[model samples]
Target: MASGKYLSILALTGLITTASFAQKSDADYGWVLDSSKRSVKNMPQQNEFLNNQYPYPSKPRSMWELGVSGGGSFIFSDIDPKFGFGGGLSLRKSLGHIFSVRGSYNGSINKGADYRLRNTYDGINGPWNGNYLIYGNKYVANYRTKVHQLSVDFIASLNTPSIYRGNPKTNIYLLAGYSILGADVDVDAVGSNGQPYNYTGINFEGKRSDIKSALKDKWDGEYESNGSIRNESRDAIGRSDKNWLIRHGLDLGAGIAFRVTDRVNIGIEQKFTMPFDDNLDAVKIGSANDFISATQFRLNFNIGNSSKNVLPLWWLNPNNYVYNEVNTPKHMKIPTPVLPDADGDGVTDQFDMEPNTPAGAAVDSHGTSRDTDGDGVPDYKDKEPLTARDCFPVDADGVGKCPEPPCCTELREKMMAKPACAITSLPSVQFKTGSLSLSATAKAVLNSVAQQMNANPECKVKLTGYYKGSDKRSMQLGWDRVNTVIKYLVEQQGIGEGRLIFSLSDGGDPNTVDLMGTTEEGPNSIPAPFPNLQKSK
Candidate 1:
């Protein structure tokens, strides 16, 4: 049973490790600026001669996080929960920019008490009265459990930086883990004289607070009796050892940390643990399981040589690669632009295949002399450049042997006709009031518009949304509708985003959008007019 429980802990740790490395292959994360080349493992001076795309940068061996924490703990069982003392030591390593694995060892002294007296037939979580008859006819519920635990926690950072941001100084994260729990639990059943506690003077008719006070005044504080231990839970794990019982526990926690310096940080954390077995409070009342809650303040230290390792990845933004390359050319290869139009041909010499051409002669896009007719002469020298195929054989002066054919006139005319395309009768798309959602009818209308744009590839569209007053809300709603339509057309209907123009019309119905063909040019999209309003899609 112990082996099976340990295997689960291994599986969870392995899964997190595998996912972290998967991102290392693709992310543009921060690389340690190690000019010394200790991490290169190759010739140090070779990096100076490398091109923009040479050996890939290596991930720096980052520093591990070590922390110590001390705080109050409480136990939840059948009786009322009371404050206790707990502290722990943890070692953590980052798996990726967002995920990390932490291992912690902790110890706590937990205590709880029940004020109500109970009999054999009493409920509300009362142990068997006959079993503890050696103590007294009526007894109160209480225990003091000293626990030791070791756990493996996985943490996910919520605010790891990406594009448009730099590294973070404060981190918020959530965590969950698996733990092995062991505790020694005991109850105060006997008086200071080493005999069963006598309950003759205790008043049963007072308020719960008053009754607890009376019980405390009449008895010694030392727990002299052994707490009731669950026979089955212990025997299943291992042989009984002293007052300690062992069980598998699950932990959930969250915390925030602030960087104090390059080597240190401070944080406050809270953790709750459930050990599955209900014997934590030294009671087997068969009512509920027991759990522990701890809230601690931490002082953490970074353990590594700062020259070799970067701060943990969770503090690094992954967009520094793009941001750096745009502003500087330190690691970039930029070819000098080659723009020389030789022979006055209008095409660059690098791309022009023909080195020389007659002055003022018409040429194709490639800068070669144009041969309008299929005859062997260039247009600048040929007298006739539009000879029909039937008149193919021409003289040296480029005059066709025969006139244009009468029977081929209609065929030539038909070939000269352009493709028929018209963006007529396109439907307008409507949106829900004060929303970004498109209705079924609006989608059907937009689909028709996409088909027309696909047929007439040369056509651009203007999508205009209406607004009431000139107030910010009215204008922003119009802008939102136009933006939504353009996104739908480009994303869902496979239309090019550049083909849709956004517009807004004042003093009209705020829920309607109009689509029309446009020959005028404008920006395809625009920024929102009032951004503080809620947004939806």
Candidate 2:
């Protein structure tokens, strides 16, 4: 029995060790990442990693456990006490992290003999030369008994939540339940071969050294009580009637388990069972019933639904939830922020080169105020971006003076010799109502006029401005448009002012027109055709 028990323990140890290694290997490759390889700010939250794809209390399903245990069982009774061997098998199911249930079948076999009665019993006193026949024979009887029990227990976990970290390593629990026991007891006289058993060369000091060899040859040279005498005692205690011998009992147990993996655990347990009868050993002399106790080593293997994600609820620590919740931020519904643009430019502050550019300024793609001619002046402040290089020392408007060329004498002689020619009409330059600013279409028209003037360099062009109103503001606005066109020509196209003439009509066309020709034949100042149309102020 000891050898068999040792082998069973070795087998269970080997299985648990193998499973533990596999569990460790899986954990090494799981979701845990190395902190050295990434910054905390960039790493996923620990709780998020642990609770991935599953929420608390609704985690993946787990398996049940099938277990076997073997160890020593002893009966507390009026008869001489003896050590016995007990073994059991159980099926356990966990309801949650804190509770579970198990059903089990256990059996124990025990043998007991009375050395004092065997030495004193005589034929006159029930076959041992004693005076009291019935009691003496009863005391001398040796008995072998077998007990089978079935029980169901509700178990409560005590330390699972505290022990389970990423992987559970241990669990401790308490259990209590109901049990039913069936027992059979057989007894006979000490000597079956017509001779009293000899105790010579035998050690009766709680040792079984040669006892296995002695009991090997059947019942020869062994102490035994008369079968009839033992049967009478059994019948008195109702053990002979199977229908009256079954017993109900209560059992309480406690155990501690060391987890080998998610799928295996090794445990040690002690359970006490009390039957409601005193005939377990066929001896009814005692006032109290017998107490049966077993202390065993348990090997439990989880079975069915072998998902790695499925762990026993007792193996899950509630601290995991607390850790995740405390460490993770709650998601809030809020509007996205608008990017800052301090200068009100189209470019945001982060990419803007001139974050504080003045309002109404024409800015470039970089948010810097425009400097079209690279003249060191912003378009907002520079009246003439195309100022000539020789005109550097000028006013704040960036207008540069045009120096006269040294060929004045020859140009005067050529002009005096040239004859008059017919002028050609040019397209009108339109303007917005009461405004002097040039539109893109007006600038394009001015470009064409500049090309024509360049082709006919000897010609002087006449520009005539008109407006619907004779008011001073209207007159001033028309004059400003004419001057703006002249400035554009001189600064942008390098056209000389002497080659241009200007006039105004009160209400002729409400637009500026140009004609190019020689001195006398070119368009002179034109009179207004609708004099009455002008606003009189």
Q: Highest TM-score: which candidate?
A: 1
Return the TM-score for candidate 2, rounded to 2 decimals. Answer: 0.45
User: What is the per-residue lDDT of model 1 for residues 404-463, given as tens digits with 9 covering 90 to 100?
Assistant: 468999976664453233353455676666788987556646755675577568888988
Q: Which number leads on lDDT?
A: 1
lDDT of each: 0.71, 0.60
Evaluated at residue 465, the lDDT of candidate 2 is 73
Clashing pairs in 1: none
Local distance difference test, candidate 2:
0.60
Candidate 2 C-alpha lDDT tens digits along 1-537: 534554665576557545643432111212122223223553445345445532322333446789999988777666555568899999988887789889999999766544433333232223233323434332343556678999999999875554224444666678999999876655543455555444455444544435444433334523233222222333322234432346799999887788876778888787889886665655555378867878788999888754333455676654554444445633222367787878765556776788898765655445676664457787568776555566676477766665656878786445434234212445677777756677755765565466546645666777777666757655665666666777777898788888877677687666554444446333333343444443322
